[model samples]
Target chain A: MQDLLLYISLIAAITYLGFKAYTIFFKKEKSCGNGSCGCD
Target chain B: MKKLKVALIGNPNVGKTTLFNRLCGVNQKTGNYPGVTVDKKQGNFTHLSHSIDVIDLPGFDSIYPKSLDEELVVDFLKENSGNSDVDKLLFIADGTNIKKNLYLLSQIKDLGYDIVLAINMMDVAKRKGILIDKEAIAEEFGVHVVKISARKGQGVDELKSAILLESPEMKTDKLIYLKPENHGVLMNYVKECVSENPYKAFLNITQENRIPEINVKKWKTEEAILRYQYVRKIIDKTIKIDKSLASDATTRIDRILLHKVFGYVIFMFVLLVIFQSVFSLSAYPMDLIDQFFSWLSGTLSSTLPPGSFSDLITQGLIPGIGGVIIFVPQIVILFLFFALLDESGYMNRIIFLMDRLMQKVGMSGKSVIPLISSFACAVPAIMATRTIENKRERLITIMVAPLLTCSARLPVYTILIGLLVPDQFYYGISLQALVLLAMYLLGIFTSAIAALVFKYIIKNKYKSFFITEMPSYLVPSFKNVMLTIWENTKSFVWSAGKIIVAASIILYVLATNGGEKFDKAETHIMTEFAQLPDSKKDAMVSTYQLENSYLGNLGKTIEPAIIPLGYDWKIGIALISSIAAREVFVGTMAIIYNIDSDEEMKITQRLDSEINANTGERTFNFATCISLLLFYAFSLQCMSTIAVTYKETKSFKWTSVQFLYMTILAYVVSLIAYQMLS
Candidate 1:
């Protein structure tokens, strides 16, 4: 159970980090201060 | 349920967003200052068995567009006018300045859309002894009028009920007619166009330039004069002010607060108080949070089985998130002060105060909004530059915006200050708070100098003008201030937390697991120090294992480059990781220290107690902390900022120039600070 949980947690963390990086850098879709890009 | 689409339109800072918040229960950014809403925000609410969708639009002075965001509103209105796409228009007007606000309302009223003219800020107007004959105004304009105080929640229910009523299209009997004979193509185009309203057709044609032969500049100036003249006549008949009962309180306060010399003195004093309060007020909560996380980590370590998963939880995630969570008190306090200043209408005064200084630096007073907005984050601040009309000024504002210390850098500064600066007060001012203030001031000073440099580099002949309206001084709404704090705090944690947690997990894996040298570290340490006691041997082995770990090797690779700035391999690791975001530096340090240390301590404690094995000196000394702070202040560490800068400039050349200059400045400043202080 411990081993399985560790693997799952690791994968989840990696996946989230990967997705966040891709969105911020590649997709260029990050929001702050009203959560909208305010772009036309 | 019936579906209704109502677009909320008004002049800026006239409580359009406040009314929208009241209707939709959505906490969009509202301020006493203008141009807060730069884009149309949508929210839906169910009322009277009707589903109403509200579009909160950017406030503009005229029906015609001036800036990009205003262009969006004009386009939206043009598309939806007299069409089923938009069911009605909700025109919110400032009751105190109805004469000025009604100009835009009159234009929209002439557009032939069913309008519910909500006279907002009725509370403020009443206090000023101004009374509006709503019935007379309604009769004159041929639209429904509702008196509302969006701040006080007065008559909001009545306004909602009014919104549901299907009023007949009311065009003012007095129309400012354009010359059809002189502009034959415009009249012909308006007739053929789907828009039945010739005013809307004219505004659209001028902007779109379908028929370029029309003298648009002359026509626009004529239209404005005619509209304001009409608005003046309506106001004269419908509103009354009692001179005896009117208050000069706002003017009285502005006299002192806007004084030439005393104004700046008071502003500096206010900043000092804010910084001092941030440290003093949040100290107890920050300490409590720190202790709680330490206890939780210790408890989890003993309770769980001695395994990688337990280690990950206790060492990786807890410390990672705790590092960020510990600084929440400070972040909350900083934003609370900002929200209060914004809500109470003082932020506008600061803009007005700084306008002179900004002009001297070759920037308009309008540049202050984006520069100040950069305090929260540079991403939206860069986006907010859309409000600035001049190309050169806007570009300069964008280039220097990221130099302002954002909320992301707060955690890094807090921890570093906690490690290096004493908590004692000198003459009722906190030393730690003083250092923090210096960091912020450094950002402001650096950005101003950078703007001056860019003013010359990015040349433009077109001059920009600064015109800001001072909102009447009123007590900031308690509910709004609290909501602003709640919303910002939530955004900070969730946004920074996600990055911190992920970085912590990856760091833990790299720090704890390695192949050849990490596996043999214990044996090598024991053999090298055979005569040492078993306890000492264990400590040596732990140190050896960490140094040979994958993360350790990676840090060592870049350690030489950062060594001159008084940084070790671990600090180098943090520098590399924090490029994703600034707040991640604390989390990275937390994870790195928690993994190597035998006993659990707060990040500040670990950092303070950190020693160089070679020199036996403190790692985070005054010099190092100051260096780190300066680096963070000047460097463009945020990926979102870089991305948004690119999106805004749409030029790789400018973005690259901004990035290179900022990074080089950060390096040179850090190098000087570290070298001199040591």
Candidate 2:
């Protein structure tokens, strides 16, 4: 059960990071130039 | 519901954003200075059984745009003129300064726009013993007028009612006319090609250079003179001012705040107070957060059965996220002070004071705002360069903006500084705070030098000029300051949290597993330390395994290049991870050191206790900490900032040059600092 949970969490973390990198690099956010990058 | 699309038009520093916030019941930023709204913002609200979409355009003084921000408004007007894309223009004007505002209003009227004049800041005008005849102005301009105080929320409902109730047929007649005989053929060509409205057609022809005989420069000048003449006449008839009751408070304060020498002294004093407060005020809350995370890590480690999964939770996720979560108090205090300075109208005077110095570096006072805003983040600061008119100046501003110390760098600095610098205070200001201030000043100094270099390289035909409005000082609204702090803190945590957690998991996996050497670490340690106790043997084995782990091999690969900078494999690993985001450096450190099931020492304490195997000395010595701080100060380590620079400049050459330049600067400077100190 512990090994099973570890694999599940590892997969989830990988997927989450993959999705985030995609959005940051590939996804063209609709910027009307309102500083929506949350960096503001 | 019926829909109405209206655009809010105004001159700068006239409370347009304040009114927009009131109308939408959402907090868009409002400052007592010009160029606050550099981008068009859209918000919607349901009122009087109609859904109204309001477009808040960046402010400008006249139809002819002086900056990219003002050009946005001109572009919006040109696109919507006589096309019915926009149903109404909600023209906001400062009641206390109606004369100068009327100049722009007169120009807009000539374009035949359907407008309702909302005279804002009536309370301020009343206090100054200035009275406006709303009916007379309305009668003269042939548009509806509403008195309002957007800050006080006094006339927002009435303004909304007027928006839905005003007739659509109330378009203003032309205030400036072109003779048909003098330019009949040009007018016909413009109307057929660009716009049917005569003034708009003339404007398009002149702006596009379609007709050389039109004498665009002469016409624009004459047009301005005529509009001002008409505006002066209108103001004389419809306004009254009593000189005796007018207040001189702003003038009196400006005498001291804008003084030649004392101005800069006061500004430096203000920065000192802000940085001091960031350290003093955030100490208790930061302590609580640190203790809480430590408790959580200890509890999870003891409660869960010892396994890989338990290790991941206790070592990877908890420590990683805790690294950034602990700095929330400092981030909040920094933004809170920034918001207060902006709302109090002191920031504009700083711009005025800095204009001379900025011009010496080949930038106008306008670049100061973007550079200052860069202290928060480079992405938005680069976007804020739209307010600058000169192309070369704007490009330079974008290039150097990332050099400023943003909130992301705060965590890295804090952890490193806390590890080495004593927490002692002198004259009621902590030593750590003074170091932080020096780091920020170092950023500003370096950026100015870089700007001077770029100014000599990039060439432009257009001249740079600085124009800003000094707004009346007012007490900052507590609600607005708190909202800014909350929004920024929430955004920082959410955005950095995702990256830190993911990086932690990947790093955890890397540090824990390896090839044959890591697998045999326990056996080798047991044989070498046969006489040691069981606990010491286990620690030796963990250390041996970590040194042979996959993460260790990767760090060793770059160890040769970084060794001159006094960095080992672990510091090299953290440096590599920081390229993802600056704050990730702290998270990487936490994950790298906290992998074993030991007592929950704070990350700072862990780092302080770190020792170099080769030298048998502290890993993070005075030389390494100073070198690391200097490196982060100059390095373009953020992918987001790199992406934003590309987006803003749209040139790979510039972006590549910026990245290489900053990296080289960081390397050379850090190398020198480490060598000299060591």
Candidate 3:
């Protein structure tokens, strides 16, 4: 039971973090740094 | 129709690539120039029914050719002119910084080619309250001028139209000539070539004045100063600007950023922030990559038949290559920051601030750029040393560049620090991060010492000059940063991946298969140890098997030499493999321990269980760990670095000497470290 709880917590935390990163990197407004928008 | 060949020439950081992208439209191919390590990029586009072929020349200050990059550009212009004629020469200039840009433009104008001027970054100039009289300037120089904002796709069409209408006709009929007393014979040749058209006469003068042989003595610093003085006179008349405002603004900014006391403080603060972000921000991506590879290996192992095929997929390729690929995120993050700093023109300030400090250490301020860049990877950083004109200085820069802790060393350092150092904070600074920073400082200090030593040892007869330009600051372009990061990360993963896979497979085979004699010996050891405790019996069998294996024999042979440094045979094997790449040490250790352990165990757990039989002590105790860290810190462990040095120096003797010296340095330093720490 203890091992199962640990696995569940790990998965949940990873999923939350992955979702956050994806949103941050993929957002249209935020993706303005490189040469994308041509504004320096 | 014959393809029109055009050469794009400019001063550095003049929106040359932004213009190239605008004209060529993403259809580009990059390769090494013939017989040189310099990158060659060519792209084709159609403008007004003419097929335009553009060659993006490397950025250079002058055609007099001091450094390798400058020589490459100048040589290409000279050689290509001799072969196929250049249809049109496009000279791009930053509109905001026209004075420095025009110095190169005037030199190109004298080369006698059909020229068109593209005044780029017009938008930035307008915002900065600078007005450029394009028509007036064009009339002054006798060339077609077009205003362009390459980043915004503004005036590109007009620029293309102007290129379509280029003519090899001089705007002025009067010729201007410089009659230096030293060039008596060359002046006679120039006089013979002069005619009614001054542009033609100038071209003829330059052609006749060209030295057939590379007489370094013929060109001196005085000549360069004289040439620049002539250029300054031209700019004083042609260019009309509010110099007071520009100089005042630059001075105000320089006071804070270039301040002797505050400059280093700010640089350290920024560097600390960048390092912290590299570790903390890249962690999520690194973890994901690690987990993905672990799942992939597990899936392949379970699905494939239990044979060499599965072994190749799971143990040999995935684990080995994946370890390298996981570091790509960190490398990209680091490069992203570097590109931003460069594009925004802040890098010039860094050079200016560090010039005095570098001079004290027997290196010019220009060496600072290459040294900082070596933190990412030494290959490009070493390539960048071509910008340093002095042969001895360039060679010394390349020699010490690898000492700067590169991104490749990050994984090894992090893992070792995790095992060795406590994760505590001192006055709000992470202890682990401080240690990492200390390693960087050690690299810099060691590189400075090496340069000072070389200054006394190597005798350079030629005089070298240090001259650098500081461009006005602007916000960095996002597109350029992303493109740089994407290209560099792709190259790193691909190049490192290829070697890692092959090395992993070879290591796996050596650990798994001993000869027929070793197979018999392993059975004998297992039978004899059967009556002992299970843990003891398992260790005994592993030890016996390793003794007879190919790697074991090689390690045992080197054991006597490395034993004083507190390394066992396993460490000796790792050291041998690490010569190809330092990161391989961890992966090789993983494979060796995995093959010997009876119960399936994580690599770190198995390593923890490893003990020295002689002392009955933990093998990777504090002393040995410190020794290994110091060895890697000092050694030239990357084969790519040696190969690049050989190519750059064009001599096997220097490369061999460099390898021998670095290896000896690593051994002696590590020996001292182990003894003192133990």
Residue range B198-228, candidate 1, lDDT tens digits: 7677767667666777778867756765666
Query: TM-score for all predictions?
Result: 0.72, 0.73, 0.67
- Candidate 1 clash total? 0
* CA lDDT, candidate 1, residue B285: 99
What is candidate 2's CAPRI-style docking category based on DockQ? acceptable
Q: What is the lDDT of residue B115 in candidate 2?
A: 84
Q: Kindly report the root-mean-square deviation of model 3 from the true structure over all alpha carbons.
A: 13.7
Tens-place lDDT digits, model 2, residues B455-556: 999998867556587787899989988998898899799988888888888888889999999999989988889999998888778778878899889898
For model 3, state the Cα shift of residue B470 in Å.
Answer: 3.4
| Best-performing candidate as measured by lDDT | 2
Worst 10 residues of 1 chain B by lDDT: B27-36
Deviation (Å) of B618 in candidate 1: 1.5
Residue B467 displacement in candidate 3 (angstroms): 3.9
After superposition, which runs of candidate 3 have C-alpha atoms over 4 Å from their true positions? A1-40, B1-183, B186-222, B225-253, B298-300, B533-536, B598-602
By lDDT, the candidates rank as 2, 1, 3
Candidate by candidate, in order, the iRMS in Å equals: 1.7, 3.1, 15.3
